[model samples]
Target: MSALLAEDLLNQMIPPLKSTDTTAKAARWLEEFHVGQLPVVTGTHYQGLITENDLADYENPDTQLAELPLRYADTYVQHDQHFFRIMELAIQNRIQLVPVLDEQQEYAGVVTVSDALAAFGPVPGPAGQGSILVLTMEERDYSLSQISRYVEENNAKILSAHVVADEHDPFRIRLTLRLNTDNLARITATLERFGYLVSAQFSGTAAVSEDEQDRFDALLRYLSV
Candidate 1:
């Protein structure tokens, strides 16, 4: 799938909070799902996001979500938006999940940050040992020769490159680059200086502790289902 959209990565298992939902139920859902926040909606119309901190002060566990102040009411993406848009919303709002909207700007579902990063990180290729970087730019602005020259200037080589047309914008494209080095600090900086958007990235050379490795292995096993 060249173009992976936000709708494709939606985690439907996480339900939205309605106006009548109480603070108690919201707290329980947050803890149950291990998420810091959840989207609050009134039918198809998305209201905002409710977080754990928003519920801590309310003395009444029965207080309705509609009664509390919500943040990031307008933070959401459309069904046709790319997964990169989901990551942008999540990072800009610092929320665990991003709410999704439909063609009419009505609530469709929610996309978790983890799911978005997971789907956006990897590119299909033979197993290699470098980092993966994703770039989004206008199709007219793309010049593989110029980009390849830039990477070469940094003393690195591009192992593989994958280009995908943006689903929402025909004039735009997404480029996934598998570099021969895990140290992307310089290449990314150089690309940014030249006006390239380094969106989602996967750095493969970080040291992983025993516990972290075990957790990752467990997650892989779970995803295999």
Candidate 2:
């Protein structure tokens, strides 16, 4: 697949407003499109993002957007930048729309968080059989090369891997992997043997075995009672 760039995800259909536009018009567009923010530009040069809050703070519908406070004048990503940077900027600034700029620093378009999520929501994996494995470890222990080596030793290939910091513990991270095999028993054993904590595993046979064991334990407790 081709690289997922910011430009590819651009919502060019969402028309940008000029600084000369009235706050009432901007607010009407925000309400109609169900977006919290909109890009304000002068010709091709992006001025900044005008948000609903900005309009509410101004409290004057007749006022021009130029007179109001437009935020993130420098908070835009290039058209060729990876989509991840767009997500980062959206999260950091707590904004819904992220402006995209071309190589010449002219406004290209805007990308919405909803659009980004839709583009990246799919689990990256091969078209064939596979299993998912979730592992939790310290941030310092994350080594993709080492983990790939272990998976390879077990005769399994990793189709895709995603890492995210654990919200409960900032020092730890969660690694989710999709392997190119249905059975994960051997791979799980190998990872555990090497001190990798397999927090969760998704496989047909393993799930059945776990369910049976839980049922057996429950039966034993009932009989004793």
Candidate 3:
């Protein structure tokens, strides 16, 4: 029932290595655990992260981590931080795994990018079933309360809504909403009559008409470009 936290994704399978550990051992563990990096710790105090690329510079395989110049030492999330923050930091730092710290600022564990993504993939779940509607309007005209009022006026409730800037026009925004009703004819009509552009519509399920599928495929290609 609770949202996932940074500590929830902590992967103990990839254990932390000590500063006195050899580069040979770190490299071996990275390969064994199928990870790009490993945490170097001095008991509860996190020393920093030692990555595969970082070890490549070492001429000797027996070199200790304490003698190595570590990167992403400060790149870590607090245990209580949101799961989204973990992904943000991972992408920002270009690392495959993120470190988590406890209340005492001690190394709690690490969260893999894959684990965080898997946990996020099914979000806004079944609550946002039925129909999905998209509207394109100027950023200044966007109002959640006004839109909710319109949906409620049609005897429907918006399950979830998200806003993104129009790719072609930064001044305009694309609002996507998941409603509780599949029959969106009345809602769409009322919105269009009130000067709102109903850009797209989709049923709750993945099944779509051939024509719609073609358009959806084209849209995916365009976004990828």
Candidate 4:
């Protein structure tokens, strides 16, 4: 499958500001666009990202962006970088927007967390015709090949897989897998037979519950802010 790169999700419509632009101008753009952050550039070169909070302490709206404390000046990914990289940077920095740069280190555009997730779609969800199986195990015992083999034995294929570290237990991990079939009884049984703990199962044939939809919306709102 082709990788979803940064350039593919770039929001060219979201304009960048010049360093000479006043804080007032940046703030206006933020309000107008309903975004918390905006990228500041010098000619084609990216300076850094500026947030509304960054300008809150500044009494003078006319202060030049060059004089203000711009953040994440070096926090940018290449245009060709995978979208996952963009997501990592956004989450790690707790920022809503990530800047993309060209090979010459010039500003390309910015990617909003909302846009990134929208492009990512519902991978391990009911949006696609597949079943979701969540498994929890010791980090050391996790192996994709082994898991795949168990599923394949039941004549099932994994459509997508995601791994997340357990927050309370660092040595444990949670694995969420999307299978190509709605019926997960056989695959679940096979995995448990091999000592893999299946924590939750969602059938593709079932409609996504209202509660789950609410949670998704809440998560997206939190990330966007």
Which number leads on TM-score?
1
What are the clashing pairs of model 2? none
Residue-wise C-alpha lDDT for candidate 1, range 47-73, written one tens digit per residue: 999998899989899999999989889
Better of 2 and 4 by lDDT: 4
- lDDT on C-alpha atoms for all candidate structures: 0.77, 0.76, 0.76, 0.76
Q: How do the residues 116-210 of candidate 3 rate in per-residue lDDT, one tens digit apiece?
A: 65654433434434665789899899898999999999999986666666656879877777677767888888898888899877653445787
Q: Residue 215 in candidate 2 has what lDDT?
A: 38
In model 1, which runs have C-alpha deviations exceeding 4 angstroms?
Answer: 122-154, 157-169, 176-225
RMSD of 3: 10.6
Full ranking by lDDT:
1, 4, 3, 2
TM-score of each: 0.68, 0.58, 0.57, 0.61
Candidate 4: 10-residue stretch with minimal lDDT: 215-224
Candidate achieving the largest lDDT: 1
Q: Put down candidate 4 lDDT per residue, 181-204, tens digits, no spaces.
A: 767778878888888898766564
Tell me the lDDT of candidate 2.
Answer: 0.76
Q: Ten consecutive residues with minimal summed lDDT in candidate 2? A: 216-225
Report the lDDT tens digits of candidate 2 across residue range 1-225: 334578889986788999999999999999988898899999999999888878888777789998987888999988876555675677567687799999899999998877765664443443334665778799899898999999999898986676766546889877867676767888989889888889866554455676544432332222122
What are the RMSDs of all candidates, in order? 7.1, 12.8, 10.6, 8.7
